[model samples]
Target: MEHSTPYKIFLLWLLLSSLMLSGVFIVWDIGILRAILQQDITRISTIILFVFFGACVHCAWRSFYLARQALMLAYLQDELVKEGSAVQLLSLFPRGSCLAQEYLVGLYQGRDAQDKVLLSEIMAESLRGTHQVGWFIAGIVIKLGLLGTVVGFVLMLSSVSGLDKLDITDIKQLMQQMTQGMGVAMNTTLVGLISSMALGVQYLLLDRCADRLVVDGVNLGQAFMSVSFDERSGTL
Candidate 1:
């Protein structure tokens, strides 16, 4: 199977993101999003939720691209088995350019079947680790947002309590404090909710992607082994 260059995939993603960001800015300028944000803490939270949702969408796209690459690599390995020449297989891949190509070269150079299998497993693990790190960062953003919301609530409540002790002569001052406190409190919650929701969705999508990769990798490995066995038997 022919595979498109990773650069092309990245460029596509960048273009998509730019378009999405432009839409977001339009909504912001039109006061639609601002009105929603002003409604209450919940609406603010919704905005936060969607931003992370966008991130998850991007991650899912990445996973799909990675899966395609893995399938291509498997197909290439199968071709190598048919050709029965590791050096010829190496020539088929782009020289010193793609990491996947390098990995295939390493696999082909392995001293034994077990060595090749080990290398494949190591490659899968490395990819999985990188994906997990992205999810971990998303989780951190969520937690920080939650913390901000909590702090905001505390301050808003404190302001309300202080207002209870003030007289009518302090009404203007009390109203100002109340509005400021409420705004701050709501802002934090909005940040937290948006961050948490977005990240949570991304985390889940990434997990699914990882699972799919593992399943596909195993299937590809089995196919490679079968092809190798057939070639060896033909020689005998």
Candidate 2:
């Protein structure tokens, strides 16, 4: 009867994300931020930062979305326990309550086969699709950082490629160019790594919530539903 609150995961994400953003702003205010931003001549580091912020926004939205679904699932469980019939379950939830409704409907319509295993597979596949984009974005951000590293190295090496006379002026220019190249490589790599790790953590939280949702959903099916077609037919 005592159900856990669904907002815990969402709230935790907000806290962790806020801390990270706060740290960035604190550093930004200290004046080193400009230098950091300016170091990446190719702007790869800046791009990575922007992309990371976008992913954070997405994770926040998704956390809220998943929490809402968890709440709906809880409500469905309460109603099912009381009414003892799944016939009205679909009507009870919103159209977006795909996980709950689909599971129940699948059970109702799958009377002939009544295969819980197959049904579970279908439900999991649906859930995975919802968060797959987040994973892809996580990976792309890291790759972009690596690309910046390569770009920086290329710039560094290209500066000395035309050296022939070994003049002091030429050497000075080459050294400056190499420093800029090193700056690009180091700054971008740092930005990319930090962004990837931060984004990865947010997605990790999302995955935990998702896993909980699946477990709770499966338990719900087992607790209130029967695999026997005849038994389920009358209830529906």
Candidate 3:
């Protein structure tokens, strides 16, 4: 836990910081900070929602490197599975494949049904961080968007409820407040849904990449599997 804690924290900070940076970039694109801040075109929650979208983008971007490595590893493993001995592939496991290395070594030893199941679990666990990080972050972005939606709804409701109390002079202020509330409501929901879709697509690709790696690995391990015909043991 202690060793892994830092990595998790880094990812957390990276997501948040990326969101903030992306927000800044978007704002800058519209105009400089001075102009964007003074403009009434965008709402605060809308900006935050876009920032969250940026965070989702960052997750997809980060997954690219891991997916590429996994794809390459799959290719190499498939080649080895076709013609080579398990012993010959030890040197070929990519970096950050400690758990996979252990699984391969175990494979070289033997792989009955029970062993295969155990190795499958190990493989999933090993690949989770690399292949699923984007998906996890995407989930977070979707939730954040929902949170924004709730907040927006609350603000809009509050403004609506107070409308009866406004006098003639306050009508203008009330209208402004209502508009802001509506902006928050509409923007948050739109950003959240859009971000989730993009993130889902991004992770879908990464998952296929992981699937290839797992398949190639399974094939590699099964290539060297031993079968027994002993009556006591049955066929294994």
Best by TM-score: 2
Structural similarity to truth (TM-score) of each candidate: 0.61, 0.87, 0.63
lDDT value, candidate 2, whole model: 0.78
lDDT by residue for model 1 over 25-120, one digit each (tens)? 897899966765664443435545565656656665666566555555655656655775444444665675333455556654566878877766
lDDT score, residue 136, model 1? 66
The TM-score obtained by model 1 is: 0.61
State each model's CA lDDT, in order: 0.58, 0.78, 0.57
Candidate numbers sorted by lDDT from highest down: 2, 1, 3
Q: By TM-score, is 1 or 3 better?
A: 3
Report each candidate's C-alpha RMSD, comma-separated, in the order given: 5.8, 2.8, 8.9
**Residue 187 error, candidate 1, Å:** 3.1
Q: Please, what are the lDDT tens digits per residue for candidate 3 over residues 77-154?
A: 565547444455555665455444556667655537788778867786665555466666667766766776677667
User: Candidate 2 lDDT, tens digit per residue, 1-236?
Assistant: 22586576678899999999898988889966678788789999888889988988999988888777777878888887787665667677666566866777676666544477677777766655557787888888889889988999999999888888568767888999999998888888888888889988898888877777777778777665543333446634
Residue 84, candidate 1: Cα error in Å is: 7.6
lDDT winner: 2
Candidate 2, residue 98: the lDDT equals 60
Ranking of all candidate structures by their TM-score, best first = 2, 3, 1
